[model samples]
Target: MADRPVPVKDLKLLDIKLGQLPGWLASRNYSPMGFVNGYRRGYNRFYSKYIDVKKGGIGGIAMLLTGYVLISYIWNYDHIKHERWRRYH
Candidate 1:
């Protein structure tokens, strides 16, 4: 018989959010939905992250989204400031 892993909930809490999915992405699987869908796949595969966000899982996803957003924002801010200073110099 084929072996199947048990449901993710039954797995330790640490396993679902920060384990196999990130490892898989680091090794491969560059698809956009990879992490978000992985969350659903681990949870119950019943909820959509998009709808969840729309209904207000904002707090949950916010930190993840904000890191990427603020990174680009700060990079752009610094780049523009550097260019202005260079033009003045």
Candidate 2:
């Protein structure tokens, strides 16, 4: 016979220490400005590493343009389909 599963409450792994709460929260970058700053920092790093002309070259530019064009096409796909249908009918 298979062993039965144990209930989560019976496990000691889920225990939390109240004393660690403040320190944990303080260590995290949780504020709105902090989020924006973190995002900008990450984006800058990515741009420099992959999207910038010096490091990434033509391939990166091509990928960026292709992505933009793909997104634009998807965004206007419904409109383009409607226009084609209107013209045909």
Q: Give the winner by lDDT.
A: 2
Model 1, 1-89: lDDT tens digits are 98897655445445556655554345533577867766767555333443355466555466667878988988799777887777542
Who wins the TM-score comparison?
2
Each prediction's number of clashing residue pairs? 0, 0
Per-model TM-score on C-alpha atoms: 0.27, 0.47
Candidate 1 ranges beyond 4 A from true positions: 1-61, 81-89
Error of 2 at 38 (Å): 4.7
TM-score of 2: 0.47
> Candidate 2 clash total?
0
